[model samples]
Target: MTLRGTVRTSYEVLTSRFGPPTFPQVDDGGLPAEDSTLWLIDTPAGRVHVHNWLDVTYFLKRPAAETRWSIQATDDAALPWIYKSVTGSTAAFSAGVHEFSRYSTRVSLARGYVTYLVQRMIALRERGERYDQGSREHRHQIELSRHVGHMALQVQQIVHDVEWAYADDADRRRWTTLPMPQLADEPESQHWHRWTRWTYRPVPTDSRPEGGDPDLVGMLRRRARDQVRFRDRILPANHRGPTREGKVELYDEHIGTLLTLADTALPDTVEQSRS
Candidate 1:
């Protein structure tokens, strides 16, 4: 196929030689695998894929509304995961405000782990421990410690804001639904997940949405509000039953200076491998 056109690239010579194109084939894995000699590229909204030559012209001619929907779906799915994590935490134990409190406990553990690591690294440096040739261990420890500290601060701020999750009856009166955000996926070790939080507020009869739309909106708002209230009123109040305590076992731990060596030596090892 002869390629032509700059911003608007075309390959019309293919049709002149091969007649018209057949349907694109789906790969064994069920993915659309275009086999055309020349494919039109698309990177809009991070959709890095090739399209059949015909699709390029078709997409260009499609209505803006269709393109807007496509863009929204791609961009919406690409948002960061951290927001999902905490929001999901609340949703898992629907109607249990205590569940949110429990999430605060996990946050505390993350904060403490970060603090302990930072202190341990600092103590190692103060004791004149050996550093790698590039001193990457020292630098990495510092950078990780800083990042952990920042996350801790942000979590602390969010947790301290009582209004973010709690509302008095007066405050609740303003809305139809409560937000019940849930994690989109399991957290990565201790990383965040992406989630959506929905909060509903009451609309006056005069200001309510038009005809059928208002009814649909009202239903959604009520569902959201009920879920939020369920979390707040149900989860935490029912905690003291049998108090099933599990047996605790402790194992002797090792003081591995080995990790320190690996952490220090790894970069050099990778460099050697490349050489």
Candidate 2:
């Protein structure tokens, strides 16, 4: 139950259930420095737990009975936006929280994986610059870059799918659009006059904002509607369909802005909550 080893530890854990999760060659920056992790996490019933290097204490925390585990790098930082969106998600979940745990957890894990891989690739790229031809280190550099490229593609795909799902027309109408929000920098007295609209919007309902520009609201809603219709055609009944990862990779390679939308789509509960 409590198994610990090198990188192989995590590999064994994933293989036990999924029968060997295939990793596309990923290159983001550097080779892992022996301290990375692989984890088989078990959360307590009715409670959600996340594994990271932070020091927040919660009551009644228990060590997971590890079936299989691997260690991977966590020292590398993620893009600020990733942290922002992920925090928003967990906060949203904890507040009105529904337990659409599976999809929600998958999205979080995928984002973490992508962020880690990108950091690793950047590290590798830095190391490769000092290589001597025909040296083992040089060869390793080439291999790492290959992996980074693959990982980058994979990250792109995840973003595309989520954005497609959120931006869809149906989703847009559901989440109600917010065309403008108040600025903290605006003086309390001047706040009413300082409203500027954001083209970015969500569908379903516009309950979040105090008020928004009428024109921007309409435009955002229409755009959200159009995108939802476009994406609905693409989502497979099983989100983890055989080609799910592959389809995401294809989108990452060809389309840009993959990162922007990946973090913003619905939390796991949206679909079920809506119904």
Model 2 whole-model lDDT (C-alpha atoms): 0.35
Name the weakest run of 10 consecutive residues (lDDT summed) in model 2. Answer: 1-10
TM-score of 1: 0.20
lDDT of 1 by residue, 1-275 (tens): 11111111123432332334333555798744663323222221122121234443343244221221010112211111111121221111112111122222222322222233333334434433345536656554444344334433333333222222344466544432544555445432222211211422223344433111212223323433443454345335445422111000000000111111112212111123344
lDDT (CA) per prediction: 0.28, 0.35
Best candidate (score: TM-score) = 2
RMSD of each: 25.1, 16.9
**12-64 per-residue lDDT for model 2 (tens digits):** 33334434223222246543322222223222111111222311121113222
